[model samples]
Target chain A: MRKNNLKGWLYLLPAMLFLGAFMVYPLIDVFVYSFEEGYNFASQTYFDIGFYNFSYVLHDTYFLQALKNTFLMVVITVPVSTGIALLISVGLSAVKPLRNLFQTIYFLPYVTNTLAVGLVFMILFKKTAYSDGLVNLLIHWFGGASVDFIEGPYWAKMFVMCFYIIWVVMPFKILLLTSAIASVDRNYYNAARVDGTSAFRIFRKITLPMISPTIFYLVITGFIGAFKEYSDAVALFGTDLNAAGMNTIVGYVYDMLYGDSGGYPSYASAAAIILFVIVLTITCINLLISRKLTRGFS
Target chain B: MNTSSQTNYEQISKTSARQKRAVHVLVYTGLALWAVMVLFPFYWMLLTSVKSYSAYNGERFPRFYTLSPTLQNYADAFTTVPLGRYLLNTLIFTAATTALMMLVIILAAFAFARLKFKGRNAVFTLFLSLMMIPNELVVITNFATITNLSLRNTFTGLILPSVTSVFYIYLLKENFAQVPDTLYYAAKVDGTSDLKYLFKVMAPICKPTLVTIGILKIIECWNAYVWPRLITDDENYYLVSNGIQEIRENGFGRENIPAMMAAVVVISVPLLALFLLFRDKIMTGVSRSGTKG
Candidate 1:
């Protein structure tokens, strides 16, 4: 038994060493740095330890803007994308012929590179000396005036951001929900049909309840993923996200550490901790609600 | 009276069949519309990629199809920037990271799943909790650590932080546990070493899960942006994720839209092909991860 223990530790040693250096230590280092006011990266020293870094980060307008953007992204993208995905999935479930083809087409975006996709989106929406972009052209065709979705009004940019996010994220949600809807017992639907229930009522009473767990799961994960969005904005708006006013919370942390106004580890750490807390709180609340709901059902 | 009731039943059946057909039409129409919406950007990308730059810019309105498609932009995508080099770098990063991660995770999973070590469950729990720590928090300090080590612009720096994934370890452990214990006892009776038994028995049994993990990890490493972006400012080490951005900002300015689209098309094709090829495995892996949450 003792020899077995030794062998186990030996096998685990490589992973443990890497995790300790990268994951575990970084977390502790971030916590310590967040509280260390006026820490200098060059000298590796700090004047004092306090909550001043947190206060400074919270008070900063750029950080606040980033907070607002991230919150809006989470609020807007999660429900809208999930609902759209659910509709698509339910539609997908009902159809028989050509189902695999449609599923494959929908899942394409999931595998595409984010930056590459962002560039495609940029060209599609961006206005230039050449012409109004494709989207604007579509608007004009529909007898609506052109709106510059990129490099335009704040609302327009936000609209484009939300649309792009929904476009990129919905594929995975659709894939999941399609499978979830498929896994639902056909007997429930048959019984509902025998009772002469309307389609909407059958969906409401049987389909929705059957798939609530998956929906809850998607919502929670969506919130977490949206909160950590940085590269998506970087891809769309460029690396200088603050100038574009579309910076996310993760982007803020990167900017604090390495952007034009960078070299402030303390501030970055503080902002990171704030993000951590927000994500953790939301996840816990969702978990509690899911537990209650599942318990009620079962 | 019986004939009248039979006629009434036939009428009800015909009406219900008509309703079902209408529902099917509605469903198919809706799915097709959404599929077009999902696919339009890719279509647009391919269309723009083949159009001549002057032709792309000269249009008063963007056309859905190009009459005289040229592969010139594809050539320029490789030449104008070192997109070829970026692709090579990405290939190297993905290969190394995935290979290293598989080794680390497989061993750790083996230890957790089969070994009777003291405090094994406790250690496993600690590893699982590591997943709760938001990656952004860890990334900040990792940047500092890599810089402090002066390992910037090296593959080692880019690959080190990504070589282990707790989630993959947990997944593989669950898979490994499903292999029956009788096999191990039989192997022991044959005087097989634990390492040999693992390689000979457990690994073959869990090949599907292993393949899924490998493919997913490759996709992840291919798409990784933030860490590589942070650790390597030198253009030599840029992955395709950041390479595409560099091409936009510097190599080809905003004026060269078609060339930019060409670059994007080249970068997106590999993974799209991979997903199409392994659609089932990828779908099952992703769905499994989601539900486990």
Candidate 2:
């Protein structure tokens, strides 16, 4: 028993070292920095600080806007994408030759850089009608005027990002759910058919119950991704657009790092900590829900 | 009853034939249209990459898709910037990280799935639970930590922070558990060492899953824009994604859509190649994980 235990530790040592150097050290540093003011945006110096940074960022108007945007993004994206992906997965499962092709297409977006992909969408959705952009061209052909997508305050910008997020992230949720979806025994469906039950009824009675755990997984993952993601705002419109959009807390951190920043990065650290806490709480809630749902996932 | 049965059979057969045709068309239309959407931007990129500056700048639709297409963008792309260096840097970082990750993740997964260790569950659970934390959140202090170490803008600073992957560990563990224990028992009975057994027995069984993870790691590392951007400031450390973004911002003209599109095509082609190569492994892994193969 002692030898076996020793062997196990030997096996685990490499992984532990890797995590210790990277994950644990960085985490500790973040906590440490949260209590201090970073110095010299140009020279990039670190200095001492009290709780003033936290208090300032807490009271800032931008903090509130970031909170609102982050939560709003989560509230919209999680259930919407998970539900739609499930529908698309189910719809495609009915086809044979096209199944692999559809899966590849669905998944291709996930592999591409989200920011680069977002740029493509920006080009497609430019304000002008029929001048090289896709959506505008379509609108012009339909005798409708082009709409300025990014110029609208906050919501339109948020919605544009959300639209792309849903389109892009759908593949991941579908991929996982497809895993759970395939596990449902075909015999149950055969039996249901013998009893004259319709496909919809069989799906409700058989499919939904089995895949609840996967659905729950998607719920939490989608929410977590939504909350922390918006670094792409910098990629899309650079610092100026992100500051105006108010769509993500992460973007706020980037803005504070590079923008006027008011000489207080300790506040950004505080914001990061709070975002971490909220996301962690959501994760805990998800764990509980997953445990409950997965009882029947068997 | 007999006369009504014949009528019902006739009606049902006709309806079924029409429905089958409709389903075929639906399948074709839906799949084909999305496929087009998926490939059109790519098509545009491929075409634009060959267009000269004058032709690309022209507002009128270039009379033909391939009218006197040139390879100058490809040439200019390499010559105008340090594209080769960035590509080399990305390749090196990706290769190193993937190798280390595979070794670390595979062993840990084996220990968790196969061996009996003290605090085994505890360690694995700690790793799994932390999977929820956005990797971006860690960058705040990671920047500070690297700065303190005087490793900023270095490849070590960029790649070291991401070497630990809970997701890959979890995935490997899940797949490893499915490998039959009888293999282990048989190997032990044959007086083979645990290392040999792992290499000779479990490794082959888990190859597809590992390939899937490898493909995933390549994709993530290749597209890792934010992390690399945050970690490295020097042009020497630029990954393809970040390199492309910088090109857009400071390198190219906004009206130079063709050149911009060319860059997209170039960045994407390797990924496309890798995906095509591993397409079979991807499906197999999915099927084993209960998704379609």
Among all candidates shown, the one with the greatest TM-score: 1
Model 2 spans > 4 angstroms off = A1-7, A35-52, A127-132, A150-156, A194-206, A239-247, A257-265, A283-298, B1-33, B60-68, B110-121, B173-205, B283-293
Which RMSD values do the candidates have, in order?
2.8, 4.7
Clash pairs for candidate 1 = none
lDDT of 1 by residue, A114-174 (tens): 8999988988888876699999998998999888777889888888898888888887799
lDDT of candidate 1 over B135-247, digit per residue (tens): 88898889999999999999999999999999999999999999999999999999999999988899999999999999988888888898888888999999999899888
**TM-score of model 1 (first chain only):** 0.97
lDDT of 1: 0.89
lDDT tens digits, residue span A132-209, model 2: 455655767789865666564555677766676777677677777766777788778655654556667988888888
DockQ comparisons of all candidates to the true complex: 0.64, 0.35
Question: Lowest-scoring 10 consecutive residues by lDDT in candidate 1 chain A?
Answer: A189-198
Q: What TM-score do all the candidates reach, one by one?
A: 0.96, 0.84
Which consecutive 10 residues in model 2 chain B have the weakest lDDT in total?
A: B284-293
What residue pairs are clashing in model 2? A179-B290, A179-B291
